[model samples]
Target: MNPTWNAIRSGLERGVIELRQTFTTAQDLWGYLFPAVVLLVVMTVMRDSEVPGTGFSLGAMALPSVLGMNVAYGGLVNIAQHLAVEREDGTLLRAKAVPGGMLGYLVGKIVGIAGAVLVSLVLVLVPGMFLFDGLALTGVGTWLGLLGVVALGLVATMPIGAALGSLFPNARSIGLLFLPIIGLIAISGIFYPVTSYPEWIQWIAQAFPIYWLGLGMRSALLPEALVAAEIGESWRHLETLAALGAWAVVGLAVAPIVLRRMARRESGSSVAARREKALQRVA
Candidate 1:
């Protein structure tokens, strides 16, 4: 095997071990459930009205969005923050001393995040079925499409997260970046349709992967629901597939450069300094 692949495998193994140790802890479970619960409550409360022209209940409209949000949180923010923190805290350096360590770390993270996302999905979908009465899944095609959307969306978004983690290389900086992330999520049709935003904001939102994820998800889960809305007609599965592919290409292209630079900058001394700095901040 290639050295990079071997390193990645090693990293993944370590990441998995760490995840298994931490998985299902109160914090992890809470992280998975809290947003799901909020989404459930909002949808249940809003079921009475048509979301604009769509005769679909708010529950139906929100289900796909909730799922998309889970993907975003896990594949993007969570991956980015955790990687950056680890890089700063010396864990990444410790792994780097071993062959295939980086690979193992990332693979483990992906597996862990995927696991958490699955848990969150069940939490959202189970209650959504009863609470929303809005889940009207059509056929095997919908299931396949939903899977395609999730997988493709993760591919498109996770690289950006990885790139950001590599670029920032510090937890404090990563946390600061969340401010803009929040704004992007708000405008990106995760909560409301992108068309609901002004023309300029709509254009800006289209540039992000979250919008594509939401659009792809809506295409999967609410294909018929689209018939009643304005942008609904534009929610083409082919376009979603194409957009996700394009984003994945871009993310893959850009992320490695950042990671390479980050690796070059990394040193044991820097990690120790970062740890000390972090401790000072906490104190």
Candidate 2:
């Protein structure tokens, strides 16, 4: 077998192992369910409210948006957190010590994170289907569009996460990312319609992948009439593709350079220093 293929296969196996571990580990299982449970509670509370013009349940409309948000969160924040923590723990340095290890490491990270995100989505969606009514899951087009949106969303966000992770000095600094992400969720219309927001805020929301991902999911899962609640009153699939594609192109171009530089900078002394800092914090 080719060396690169071997590395990739090893990475895939690593991902599978880690994914299984996630199910077995109590903490990991909680990490997976906590957010889903909170969102379900909120959706249940909002079950009676209706979307502005449509008679459909507001919780039902919000369900797909939440799924979209989860995709962005997993692709961006989860990867960033993992990379930062692993780097501090000397995992990246260990990978750097081997010829094809970095490739395998990255492949493993992607596979593991993507699998976790898919499982998380299923956890949310299955309960949502029973709790809410009028979800547009009838046609083949809906499923295909959803799959495309998820693929594009991950492509657009994961490299950016990798770049951000390389830049963050330690796992503790990853908390800074949460504030902005929460702010983006607010503006991205995860809980409400973007059309209800101010014109400028709507534009800002549209500028990011989160909003488009939500809109894409909504387009896939909601009735056609609900488009009245969206900005431009259309799905804007072309713009969604263009925006996500642009982000993917730029991130793919930049992440490798950033990650390579970060990896090059890693050393025994640096890892030790990080460990010392973490110990001091614990003390």
Candidate 3:
């Protein structure tokens, strides 16, 4: 058997094992459920309110945007978190020591993270469909569009996460990423209309994959009449694809180079040093 094929198979098995662990482990289960509960609560609180220019429930308008934000959020943060922690713990070094181990490691991480993203989506979408009044869950096209948006969102974000992870000196450094991410979410209109922002801010938001992902999700899930509340009274599926596809291309191009460089730098001594620093911080 080809070594690459062997690595892929091993990676798939690892991914499945980790995905199964998501259901079994207390921390993983909490990670999924807590956010869902919070989002549900907030949406419920806003159930009676309306979008700025439309009679649609503000909660309903937000449901799909929040769902799309989840995909982007999890893809970027989870993968980066896992990579940072694992690198500090010597996992990357161990993988680097083996034939095609780095490839297998990445594949497993992507699969596991993607599966986790889907689980998060379902936890929200299943309940939101019942609670939210304006969702267009009645057709095959809507469902297919949702899936397409999700796939593209994952592709756009995960590789960038990997690249960022490789740059982090330790797991604690991941905390610094949060403030910027929060700012992005704020402007991306996860819970409000992007059109409400100034034209300059709106242009900045539209430049990123997060905004496009949220737009795609809204396009798939919200009623056609809700377009009036959007920036240009349109879903602009083509613009969504172009923006996300550009991100996908850039991430795919950069991550492999960065990961390879990071892999080359990983050594047992480096891992041990990082562990020592982490312990000293604890002490």
RMSD of each: 2.2, 0.9, 0.7
Q: Model 3, poorest ten-residue lDDT window? A: 201-210
Q: Sorted on TM-score, highest at the top, how do the candidates line up?
A: 3, 2, 1
**Poorest 10 consecutive residues by lDDT, candidate 2:** 50-59
| Top candidate when judged by lDDT against the true structure | 2
**Model 3 over residues 42-85: C-alpha lDDT tens digits?**
98898999999789999999999998999999888889999999
lDDT per residue for candidate 1 within 1-283, as digits (tens), equals: 7888776666566657766766648887677667877878887777786677667776677788778777876778878888888898787787667676666666877777766676777788777766665455768988898888888878888888888888784887888777887888788876666677788997787777777787777777775656455354567667677877998999889987877678767898899888888889899
Candidate 2 root-mean-square deviation in Å: 0.9
Q: Give the Cα lDDT of each candidate.
A: 0.75, 0.93, 0.92
As for candidate 3, its clashing pairs are: none
Q: Write the residue-wise lDDT of candidate 2 on 70-138 in tens digits.
A: 999998899999999999999999998987899899999989999999999999999998999899988
**Stretches of candidate 1 exceeding 4 Å from the true structure:** 1-19, 223-225, 230-232
Q: How many backbone clashes does candidate 1 have?
A: 13
Candidate 2 to truth, TM? 0.98
lDDT of 1: 0.75
